[model samples]
Target: MSQATPTSQSQNVQTVTIEREMNEYGALTVHVDGQNATRHIVEYASDELKTILRQLPSGSSVPLTIEPIGTRGNAWRATSLTQ
Candidate 1:
């Protein structure tokens, strides 16, 4: 009999700052330094992180740890966020 081993996906975490945008839909985006100018979306941010982000004023440069989603090299989601 042959058995298959399960593998876990590695997490890619990076510290970055939020780049707030002014529009109807309040979306969160961050730009990682030394990389392309593509804006990453914080789609899967935690509640605590989301609350902290929401309180911050526009154009705020707060450091945060973000994890990129599947296949999205430029897209990101906050894992650990602090003001």
Candidate 2:
């Protein structure tokens, strides 16, 4: 038997940019751009994005996901990039 995969328009897109900032709670403000990026917020932040910042090249685009953690905040989690 053969299996099929679910279709999702929000998959496989790569990051165009990522930035980190801080708020009163010491949260990370991450700005990421990707395919159909306009569908998302202007910019968001997360602890995960803070983890991967130095590892990534300045101005290098990476693959990530927009994760929502309720009251905590939203974050950009890097999984992969164009390379």
Candidate 3:
């Protein structure tokens, strides 16, 4: 398993959406603008993040601080999230 580390500084991403269901690996997937531009996934989401997601409705646009997870820069993770 790849250890998710913040490769770079936090990026201000807009129009972020967190999937309601977890993937096969039990990780929460996130998308920007309904597309897979920056494949951000939360393998272990914080309690705060979970609370935020549960309160918001589906397809709601939220602010997120995304960072590249691995050295490959192909995968990302949500370091911070806001409404």
Q: How many residue pairs clash in each candidate?
A: 0, 1, 0
Q: Write the per-residue lDDT of candidate 3 for residues 23-56, one digit (tens) a residue.
A: 5454555567756564545533476665555566
The ten-residue window of minimal lDDT in model 1 covers: 3-12
Write the residue-wise lDDT of candidate 1 on 1-83 in tens digits: 55333223434444445567523354666655556654555454466666766676655665565555655366556666544
Cα miss at 31, model 1 (Å)? Answer: 2.6
Give lDDT tens digits, candidate 2, residues 1-83. Answer: 45333234334344556354333443433444634342222233445544554455445455554433223333333333334
Q: Rank the candidates by TM-score, best first.
A: 1, 3, 2
Best by lDDT: 3
List the global CA lDDT of all models. Answer: 0.55, 0.41, 0.57
Of the two candidates 1 and 3, the one with more favorable lDDT, higher being better, is 3
What's each prediction's TM-score?
Answer: 0.55, 0.34, 0.53
